[model samples]
Target: MKTMIVIPARLASSRLSEKLLLRAAGKSILQHTYEAAKRAAITDSIIVAADDPRIVAEVDSFGGEARLTSVDCQSGTDRLAEIALMHSDVDLFVNVQGDEPEISPATIDAVARLLATRPDADIATAAFPILDESKLHDPACVKVVMGANDRAILFSRASVPHVRDGITPAHLQASPPIFWQHIGLYAYRRDFLLWFATQPAGRLEQLEKLEQLRAIEAGKTIVVTAIESSPPGIDTLEDFREFVARIENQ
Candidate 1:
């Protein structure tokens, strides 16, 4: 399958203002993410789908390919859809968020490979087992409920597969994890991207603020790839400071 990685770079971040342009270790977050994507074993065809000219310039500063997408795009998936329209020859388009500077190449390969192997699935995404009860309850940590054959049943900000009787260590330690934290990474079949762009956000999606639920509500098959763990993306000033500290220590 012909695969391409697309980093959706948006200038207006709500949580942290212009977070992608924020520098750490002498490189902007977008540049770091692009460089990480380059290290992935998948096809080297990568592009930054930017909503601002400054973002395009930043990508160019680092010698990375970028195209200015419309600011009217509601979500990163929408941005990817615009790119899909232009690159019809690409079979699979991977959505690598521009904020994820520490995203693993193995995770990218895993998600892309899952989509390539599962013809029934319209999308493939990564998730890690959530062992901490606090994190499971935290709305900030999106949870992925998995159904049979590694298919995602639902995604939500609320705790799912709810321990009706009350939580237990055994449940958390089950062979097949009882809880999974959804990673932002996604791999979409070209058709899926085009289809997603045409549809309106689902009721559940609007409620939970999870874009993936829009697909699930539409009866789309989404496969989940289990990874051991993934580094958190930069969201707050504290997260950025921690990222910088990690880089300095390294």
Candidate 2:
């Protein structure tokens, strides 16, 4: 199956402005993400869908492929749809976050392969077991509840399966966790991407402010592949510094 990895980068980030262009290790964050995507054997091609000319120029300077998308594109998925219009040959499209410079190539390949193998599923995503109790309650950390056969049943900001009978937080943290943290990486069929762009904002999606819920509300099947811990994404200056320190130490 032909798969294309698209990294949607925007300059005006609320937390850390221009985080994607921030220098990390020896390369810009976007460049690092692009190079990592190139290492994935499952992807047929890699493209950076940028909203600003500055990002476009940066990608060009680094000798990486990039396409200028509309700044008005509502979300990354919308940007992916814009990129999809130019490439008709792509069968599967993987959405790789531009800020995640340390994203694993193996995780990218796994998500793409999951969608390629599961014809019934419109989308495929990755998740990792949540070992920390603090992360479970953090709304910023999205959670996923999986159904039979690794199919995603729901995605929410609140802790799922709220253990009934007044179970203490201590009990929740004990051995064998019950929840999974939703990883941002996703892969979707070309047709599904197009269809998703036309659908209006779903009720549950708007309430939770999670775009992935639009798919779940529409009764689409999203298969999940559990992966090891996902690397930290660049959301603030501190996050970028931490990434640099970790990479340099390694």
Candidate 3:
């Protein structure tokens, strides 16, 4: 099964406009992400699914493959679906976020392999342990609950597995934790990718603003793999600056 990694990039970012074009460590963010995906062993090809011509040109300038997708694509998954439409030979599609310039190739390979092996699974994603107590409570940091066989039971912004016992919140924080942080990277089977494009957003999906919830609501299994670390994604100016500093230090 061939795995194709498609990075959905747009010039008009609400938080940081043209973030993919932003310079970090003397390389554009999109270029970094594309190169990182290329490093993954499981991927047969890496393509940029761009909604804007500027982003397309940027990818082309770096000698990277890019395709112009519909600007009407509401999300990354939607943009990837458009790319999938043109490439019928691809068996697996991996959605790599454009802001995740520091995304690990190992992490990408792990998720793609999981989907490739699990015939019953519709999607595969990655998660890492949330060591920070503050991040555990942060709604911006999505949480994922994994079940037997490493399948995701649910994903939400709210903290999961509420302590039923008389354990105080402070004490619970001090104790070893079972919570995990959700990573945005996703690998979907070709059939599921097409089905996902047609389905309407479910109630849970709308409430959580997570497109993955639609799959869960439809009884689709999502396998979650554990990763040691994930690099910080560029969402704000501070994040971009920190990424630059980290690259320079390296």
Candidate 4:
């Protein structure tokens, strides 16, 4: 199956404001993400599905391929749909969010591999065991409830599978793990993206502000690949600053 990586970059960001254009270690965040995606062994083809000419220009500056998508696209996956329409030859598309400059290439590979291996699955995503009690309660850290065979039952910002009695350190440190922090990285089949674009946003998706839930609510099978951990995405000025500090310190 032909696979490609698409980094959906919207120039306007609610938290950090044009954060993809923000530079760290002499590279724009979009470029950093693009380069990181390129490092993944899954596929060599990478495109930045940009919502603005500025983002296209930025990609051009890095000698990377980019296509201008409609600004009206609601989510990153929607932006990738636009690219999917253009590249019919590609069967699978991996979404590595432009904000995630520090995203792991292994995580990218894992998601792609999972989707490629599972014909029953419509989408494949990565998640890591959440060892921290604080992250379980923090809405910022999305939690995934897994059912069986690595299939995701649900994705929510709220703490789920509510320990009923209580959550203890043992629950957090369980062998199989009771809590998982969902990563934004995803590998979507071409047909899934096409069908997803035509469908209106699901109720659960809008309520949680998570695009993946739209598919979940629609009864699409989403498989999850367990990863060790994930690097932080740049969502705010503080996140960008911390990323810069880490890069500079490196």
lDDT against the true structure, per candidate, is 0.94, 0.90, 0.89, 0.92
What TM-score would candidate 2 get against the native? 0.95
- Model 3 residue 171 CA deviation (Å) reads 8.6
Quote model 1's TM-score.
Answer: 0.98
Q: TM-score ranking from best to worst?
A: 1, 4, 2, 3
TM-score comparison, 3 vs 4, better candidate: 4
User: Against the true structure, what is each candidate's TM-score?
Assistant: 0.98, 0.95, 0.95, 0.98
| lDDT, model 3, position 153 | 97
Task: Note the clash tally of each candidate.
Answer: 0, 0, 0, 0
Per-residue lDDT over 35-60 for candidate 3, one digit per residue giving the tens place of the 0 to 100 score: 98899999889899988899888998
Tens-place lDDT per residue, model 2, 1-250, is: 8899999989889999888888867799999889988899898889999999999999999999889998679999999999988889999999999998889999999999999999999999999888777887899999998888889999999988676765466665655556889989999999899999888999999999999999999999999998868988888889988999988898
What C-alpha lDDT, on a 0 to 100 scale, does residue 247 get in candidate 4? 94
> lDDT tens string, model 4, 71-186?
78988889999999998999899998899998888889889999999999999999999998999899999999999899999999999879989999999999998899999889
Candidate 1 per-residue C-alpha lDDT over 69-167 given as tens digits, one digit per residue, 9 for 90 to 100: 987898999999999999989999999999999999999999999999999999999999999899988999999999899999999898898989999
lDDT for position 157 in model 2: 97
Task: Tell how far residue 230 is off in model 3, in angstroms.
Answer: 0.9
Poorest stretch of ten by lDDT in candidate 1: 35-44
